[model samples]
Target: MSFNSPLRDEELISKQVFERMVDIVGTSHIVANRREIMSMTEVLNRSAIKYDVPFRIATSGSMGEGFRFEESDMDVMEYPDGFQVIWDHSQNQHKSFSEGEIFVFDGSHSPPGYGLLQILSPEELNSSKLLFVKYGNSYLSSTFWKKTFLNPILGSRIHGPCISSNLECLDFDYAECLISRCWPPMASTFLSRCQLWPNPQTLQDIVNKECHLVPIGHKLGNHEEEEWMISFSLAEKALVYSMNHSQFLLYGLMKLFLKEIINKGLDEEEEILCSYHIKTAIFWTLQQGSSLECCQRNFLKCFWVCFELVTKWVYEGVCPNFFIPENNMFLTKCHGSAQRKLFCRLNAIYDVGPTCILNWLSMQDRSPSLYSYLRGNTNDLYIKELYNELAVFALPRYLNFQTCVRMLKSIVKSAPSNRDGISALVARMTYVSMLQHVAFQLMSLKKEDYTRDNNFDELSCLAIMQTAKLGSVSDLILRAMYSYRVKKYPEALFILKMAKVWLKQPYMIHFGYLDTEYSSEIAACPGNSLLEVVIKSFVFSIKLENPIFYIDELFTEQEHSRKNHWSTIFIPPFVLLLMLEFLCYRHVDTQRAQHALDELFDLMHSNQDSYLTSVFQDISWQILGICQEMAGNLQIALYAYMKSLVEPIVNRIRSATLQRIQSVKRRMCRI
Candidate 1:
């Protein structure tokens, strides 16, 4: 289970690969360039006082982290700290308002307090006025009203209320802007929720430090609107700085993978995966046990491990917010089926091994043509089309239509019993039909559209939408399979019921209804009858209390193989059974709860040690303790509670376990 191992190629090859990545990304150069930009901004701020420019520049994003890949945009904010206005009676016969009252001048012209208006040229003033008119009153703020209102008048040189610059350093470019706000302290609630590092004091100290927020506004269509987003760039920088050289190199490699390989050919319109996701993956990976040390030794292995973690998140349809676990980064940005397709693409890379990526990178070094071809013809193709193509191309060539037919036939031949045989055939056929449906739509695309970006994107989007219709059906089939395996007849029957509904109305993938044609095709599929029979049998068996007859019905020979793999698919039903027997049943069925706990523990032990295994063990122990406590077995319950505290994976869970232990001890004392 130790991921850290000595490099096989005497570290020479890995070192060269790392150096080549550095050459391509210039991550270090970006960091230095950002520092130079910060220095220049400071100087600019000092000089601007004479000209009455009231804005100061602050940095955020990858630049704030002190390292960015070649493609990263440096996020800058301009704060309107000390902006004011001057009124002159000689220029206009008008009185100025102060504190909600107008004051009249005594027929003599005098410069207003601070004489701030004297520094601006007439053209600048005119531009400012025109901008104010364009933006209207909504842009004004009470604290920096003059600066906020005058931002538009500042011309193209100013972005919003702050001066803007896109600096070029060592051939890398980053956008900088002045926004009218100072750094905001981190929210106390958010800080409290953060997963504490081993050294809680360090995390506490970091949270107490102030960090700037960018007035980039809320995100609209994955693009920031005119709202402020908290910037943790400085904290991110400190964390990265603390990493050893090897850890830093691996991070750079990950960035290179995201930018050069994964994001290649994605246009502005595409929901291109960002480097932030890769960084977040790294952050999570590092937090899990001693993964950082593992990465330092087995760079390639650890790189793939991190990639797998990212793929797992994508598969689960959730990319958790690194700092805040509750914030699902992918919820709004990516659809479930789309995320699955992404996982498939990444998994394909993994299946081919890291050497393939290294080889691709090497080929890129030798010739741009090879890289371009590998990047695919995205220029004329839509992003949707590109994704479809990636998913299609990533599929193994061996899995052809005939091969699929053979596989389905093999499932029928290897069925454990008559009942299991029928169920297996039905599930396999449904899967095949779904695949065939996708293939049919893909084939229907115009031949010319295959190469043209415009047509490809449109065609691809249609194909993917059609393909997405299968997700619900597929999910239900898998759920039912697990439920059946675990002998949860009622749960399995419920899942099958859901599957039937989805089969009838396949168009209802999300909130909206898809075209009737898609639903009609699914409804008309031949597997529906077989699916119905399996569902009916399950219902009858569950009612008769003859769950054992159907329980032995294994879906396919492959199910035997999956016995070794610990998955959430298995955990859900097991947990459901536990909850039903222990908490919801008319009588607290201690025997049934014990049975469920046993099965869960067995599954956990069968799987390799992992965070998930730890979680499973923790839950199993807690439930066992509960069962013992309810049965008045104080000594056994105390032992189970003590066991629950052993090596809990999640910090939050560990805290809960400690409290539970204390509760158990108090109860035992009372007894």
Candidate 2:
């Protein structure tokens, strides 16, 4: 029994004989379900016709339960113009396979085009040229050509030819013809032209269409006993491209798709799709624990570019139909083109690396020392002026204050500079200050009326409190101005408390290393630090229903008697000031056994501190004015206080004011 079976001879025939059959029929007569594969087969058939290779198309099917296709047993006629297919039949078969003219017409097919092929020598095909491998075909090898050509195009293209299916069997010369022509033939070319319709607009579309979601079978004829067998491998390498349950691969492909979209310019709808895919890719990458640096970098780049483009559109007054409130101002007409122009000018700034931008805006610029960037030259006042200047543009949008606050804070944190630095900065903002000279300009825009908006008042108060931490002269001035604006006595008294804190605690004063921690003997004593006075003022301004508790831990642990007499003087004056200020404000509920002023008056007249008497008198007069609500009398009280503003021996009569004695005289006269 020869291994060279008669079935093999009947299967392939010769490439020359196949061409003669096709030449007789012409290209249009033979029908193929797929035009591209048909076109490819026709071209090979034409070549076979020219070369005189014997070939035949095999008509095959299993009549019983067993049905399979063999590689070498089946063949189809080939021609230079088109295929003249012939059918093959087995004599020993118990069951009948279909017998008819193998060239069955299908209505769907493309018009013919020129056919061409160039056969390579065995060395050429084995060398750099790619191979065309059929699973059941022994002649062909699984070489580069196979992967680059056969598998993607012809192997995937041909559907399993069923018993009654229009495409019933393989054309043997199809493989040989494809292999002989187009060395390193492009699989993409055949696959591309085989497309259903309209063609794939993008690479993603191509993958979506050609790659199968499930396993499919292929056909080749068996030589021995003229039978066919279906071959299944334990695992298929091509299954990677198949529709498997491996979601990870799909996700990877999606990311790859998004990367393609981002690199290639896309239209608006495409851009939106791109964003969705990119977002999903990000989530998938994270879920899969992929730490690819290239993936992250590309994602960031894509995100940043999209963000910038969207922002630019808004700036150009073409708001994308999306909910992006952050860009509302950019779309507003208040600044008109000015705002858009500004964005254009600042595009370079926005192009900064993500980390650098975040760090800079968040006041975390620790590199290059934040100070060096903020500190202007002896004459450079750009940053200082920025707060005031931006205040104007920001006010209309209700963002001025926040903008100013951020700018000033960042600038101050960026460098250590002083109140003069602050002043110079204001000089650059002369126009802005003029624009916002009155607080009502902005306050009028408050959602609540000024009187009804206690929250705003509280925020304003908080702003003042925080300003004391900055400790600039402008901050001090701003604090005073805000106090007058609110007309809340406790709010003003709180400033005195803050000022006391400023005098006693460590605080940064200037932009560069210009922090001050004032704790000399002057700051140590209650009188020297003026904490006693501030406390007294606070106590008088606030009407506490419960006895107010003081923190003992706040005071230094030094013995009282060991300190100076003037330090001791602070206790008496502070107590007297508290009682007198309260009496002035009508906050005191009762007269105690020991009058605060009298006790302090006795101490002052003892000459322990002569200046204390005059100070008491000034405080007394202030009490009188507060009680009377007399503007002129308040002036007189202010004069008295000013008179005793001396470094040492600051003095006057006892704590009783002339106004108090005069009030008694009036009552007595009435009696």
Candidate with the greatest lDDT versus the true structure: 1
Q: Per-model C-alpha lDDT, please?
A: 0.43, 0.28
Query: Lowest-scoring 10 consecutive residues by lDDT in candidate 2?
Result: 540-549
What are the models' TM-scores?
Answer: 0.37, 0.18
Alpha-carbon lDDT of model 2: 0.28
Model 2: per-residue Cα lDDT over 1-671, one tens digit each: 11233443321322222222222211221111112222222232232233232432211111110111122122221212221111111221332323321221111111111111112222433344332222322222212322333332322343321111111122222222211111111223333442332223432343332111011111111211111111111011111112212222223333333334222354443233333223223332332333323222243343344344444543554432111112222222314555455445435445653222222211221223222323422211221222212221111111234333443343344332432332223222221221222232334345755566355645544544554443333333334434534454455445534543442233211111112232122222444222221211111111010111111210121122112111111212232333332332322222421243344334333553312323334333333333332222334434433333322331222232343345545544666
Candidate 1: RMSD to truth: 25.7
Instruction: Give each prediction's root-mean-square deviation over alpha carbons.
Output: 25.7, 38.7
Q: Which portions of model 1 miss their true places by more than 4 Å?
A: 1-16, 22-53, 61-69, 82-205, 216-227, 292-296, 362-671
Model 2 CA deviation exceeding 4 Å by range: 1-456, 460-576, 580-595, 610-662
Give lDDT: candidate 2, residue 233. Answer: 12
